[model samples]
Target: MIPLIEARGLVRIYEIRKGPFSRPQPVRAVDDLSLSVMPGETVGIVGESGSGKSTLGRMLLGIDRAQAGEVIFDGRQMPPLHSQQWRALRAKMQLVYQDPLAALDRRLTISAQIGEPLDIHGIGSKEERKERVRELMGAVGLRPDQAGRYPHELSGGQRQRAVIARALAARPSLLICDEPVSALDVSIQAQVVNMLRDLQEQNGIAMVFISHDLKVVRNIADRVAVMYLGKIVEEGSSDTIFQFPRHPYTKALVSSVPVPGKRLQGRVILQGEPPNPAARPSGCAFHPRCPLATDICRTRTPELRRIETGRTAACHLLANDLAVAA
Candidate 1:
């Protein structure tokens, strides 16, 4: 079966503006990343702040144009912004941002905010639109009466719920969430995450969950992808990634997760911050911090290769000492 969403050789570069007479430097935000999402499956993408997870998320949802590469959904190429095909595809894909307040229009009422998409798509009559908004509110765990309130009137959790309601109002097939719960309090984060899981099960919608928190991703993702310096270094089932990480970067990231009274032997602590995107390192991007890096790693780039059942890693050490203990 074909994947619901497939990205091949995806690359997105942004040109930075310098002062007068200065040449613009192109920053490679996403460097030839490839990903596929099965129907009704949740794929988790985790990395540090500048790891390009959010940029990939935006490209997946058609919110950002790819400098090179293609994003195909259900066998159709996604069109660029404002094109005829893009207008039609927008109805099937939606994005939920990290800061709900930033996405929400503070001047508009909740009802209008939710109803606007339905209205733009010409989904239903005015009365039916109002009813649909009410149903959407209920779907995201908001009361029907809350539709009249402004965004400032609600708490952070409520604002996020409202944002989810608005995204669902479009009846999108794929939902790209970019750090959806990173801004909320610890207690409320669980509630939002659980709500998303419940919604996905009920709607059978495919999701691309992008976040920096591995713990949160572990609870919701069936498969997990680990990225570093704008490239996916490792990807596999969540259980395998958390329990038996093969890549040194994956091992170091998992070690950082707090586990009370449980100390892992030979835990690897990654050294130094990720290199600048403008001037990335010569060979393997993680070589600067990889304890297993060999001389070849510093001079040659490692291609992503299949390492085990349903697991892939981009590392030159995959031939010998890369085996993970069972």
Candidate 2:
């Protein structure tokens, strides 16, 4: 089956301006990354801060253009930003931001914000759009009375629901949710996550869930991608990744998640901070933090290759067609 959205070898760089009279430093926010999401599939992208997860999300939606490579949505190349074609395409792909208050207009009521997308896409008549807005508010579990309330008047969870309601207002084919529930409480996070999952399954919407929370990703994703320093270190089925991580970075990330009622015995605690993008490491970016780094890991970059069916990882220690770790 053809993917709903595909990013091929995307590269995005930002030039950071330093002190007075200092030259700008180049930071490759996303480097040579590629991904695709099939209809009704959820691909979770998990990584540390500055790993380019958010950058890749914007690039996939064409909000951030790549210096190299292309993005194809529904078999058509993404158009230039703000173009007519891009505007029309926006109705099919939507983004759910991490912060709800920031995403919503303070002056407008929740119902107005939810109904705005229908107006933008010209989806229906005035009465039909109003009905659709009411249905969406109900779908996201928002109360009828809360419709007229401003963003600041609602709780964090309620505000997030409003944001989600607005995103769904467009009936997008693909939803890119970037840390959508990170700001909410644990219980609220579960509610929102389950709501998103149910909504996706019911609508058959493809999703790209980007988060730093591994547990949440494990719950929502069919496939998982472990990224570090703008590169995908591991990609595979979510179960294989959580149970039998092969890459050292993937292992460390999975180990960081505390298992319920279990004491930490074989946890892989990594040392040192991730290298700055302006001055990335010589060979493998994770070598500075990898516990098993060797001469080869420090001298050459490992390509992300298949170690087995439905699994791929980049690590110098792993042999071809064989895993270094179970």
User: What's every prediction's RMSD, in angstroms?
Assistant: 1.9, 1.3
Model 2 poorest 10 in a row by lDDT:
317-326
Which residue pairs collide in model 1, if any?
none
Tell me the whole-model lDDT of each prediction, alpha carbons only.
Answer: 0.89, 0.91
- Models 1 onward score TM values of 0.95, 0.97
Give the best candidate by TM-score.
2
The residue-by-residue lDDT of candidate 2 on 179-230, one tens digit each, is: 9999999999999999999999999999999999999999999999999999
Q: Write the per-residue lDDT of candidate 1 for residues 17-83, one digit (tens) a residue.
A: 6777789988888999999999889999999877889999988877889988999999988878888
Evaluated at residue 96, the lDDT of candidate 1 is: 92
Q: Candidate 2 regions off by >4 Å?
A: 260-266, 320-322
Q: Show the lowest summed lDDT stretch of 10 residues, model 1.
A: 317-326
